[model samples]
Target: MKVIHLHQEEKKIIEEAVVQNRQAQHKLYVKYAPKMLSVCRQYIKDLQQAEDVMITAFMKVFVNLKYFEHKGSFEGWIRKIMIHECISYLRVKKEMKFVEDEEFTHEMHNNIESQFSVEAIQFLIDALPDGYKMVFNLYVIEGYKHHEIAEMLGISPGTSKSQLSRAREVLQTQINSLNKFNHGTI
Candidate 1:
């Protein structure tokens, strides 16, 4: 079944939400909550905690709806908010200690997407130290520049690059190990 385009309706809902219309707010929440939760889960490994962050972010979104100009996708705007909320949650929940390495070689993990399930990849990411995971997700998943990540996470761009390099190395090692074990070579 083809779903009708939501942009026109979303604009109307967004306007109503700006005025604090409860039903419009509820509709927006129902439409966005699932995707927002997934965005939260990318940063937060715990589903329940991700949900909490998503809810908090949604509240902020509704509160700040008036500031949302029609220049971009509402989903993207919400996602940015969700990412910030996750960062805040992580900050309060755990300290992210970034390692400063300016010269680590970048290692790419190739051809694993076909072999690894999304959950498996997420598990590997979840295993990373908080700082590495945050940089890796921002750089790799969310396509943020290192400088942007550094600014957002309050670290140097060099530190962000280093964290990404280290994260790639660790994930590559783990995936290689998994490949060997699965192929009975280890």
Candidate 2:
């Protein structure tokens, strides 16, 4: 039940820990773990796996803490590590295999807007089939280009685009359905 106050003393303790004080290091981990765990949970579907990933990611963060200049937020640095860990975990899991199908090339639509509730959008994302979810997460949420997604997932750029398009269509359909339901109920 520790309150995370980013006061001068807290920052000084973290800086001291980065300079090799074991107690401050432990305190830093205790202070940051809850926040970092929440970030890990968003990227990973399973709770236990999220905890494992966070643990490993924090270890890496602690090891590299000395390299952290005050250039960015400390939380942002930890977030990047957690994200990389999640990517590695997903890559190893191979939950969805990426296939290159030339017939499924996607043409991007312009200026699409969504006014759905956050819960509705999350529901749609969670409902997506595994392959579509992975590609959508990487390309849309993570801001990865199709070529990079193709390289990372062993799929063709066309397939990456197609998957993203399909994911969007599915999401839009979900939103429409939810909107209809809302209108009907009201």
Candidate 3:
């Protein structure tokens, strides 16, 4: 594992928390909760459900603090925990399924060159089917490789790639329509 040098104050807080210091743990929670919650929200649509997942993730973080070897950024470690929690929650709720690559229709070829806002793009992503949305977010937004996504979702790498392709096709179609509508060309 690569050694990561954290700020002295951050290192001190982590050391204290590792010893089960409640105050230090609370400090860590306060510092990371919002960002972790946002990560949870990306996978969970319901706000309350996302909050619950965040809490569960934090609990795991505290319980497993001793296992953290400071090999990477502390925040990255926390983010991984939160992401795992979200994946667990999604697996239980969605029972994610994947179709074989051969089953997918030919990929749609649409050029989407719109000046849509980030909010609009996010809305379109949220509108995707649950499986597609999860795969899309993991691969596109989170920068995870298809094989990594497959491992996380318990699907084959081909399934992950196909889902991502479908997601982009859908997004492109939506963006094109929006662009046309906005330009009065619809």
Which candidate's lDDT is highest? 1
Instruction: List residue ranges in candidate 3 displaced over 4 A.
Output: 1-6, 102-114
Please, what are the lDDT tens digits per residue for candidate 1 over residues 1-186? Answer: 223456777898999999999999999999999999989998998899899889999999999999999888889999999999999999887757888777766655566554888898899999999999999999999999988998999889888988998898899889889989988999
**Across residues 26-87, which tens digit of lDDT does each residue of candidate 3 receive?**
99999999989888887787889999999999999999998888787889999989988988
- Which of the two, 2 or 3, has more TM-score? 3
The local lDDT score (0 to 100) that residue 171 gets in candidate 1 is: 91
* Regions of candidate 2 where Cα sits further than 4 Å from its true position: 1-14, 19-23, 26-35, 103-117
The 0-to-1 C-alpha lDDT of every candidate, in the order given, reads 0.89, 0.77, 0.84
- The residue-level lDDT of candidate 2 at 12 comes to 84
Which pairs of residues have clashing backbones in candidate 2? Answer: none
Candidate closest to the true structure, highest TM-score: 1
Which scores better on lDDT, 1 or 2? 1
Across 1-186, the per-residue lDDT of candidate 2 in tens digits comes to 244455567778879888889899899889889988876765676779989999999889888988887676777788778777877887788766555566663555655466777655666787887678778877776687989978876788889888888887887767767777867963
> Candidate 3: which pairs clash?
none
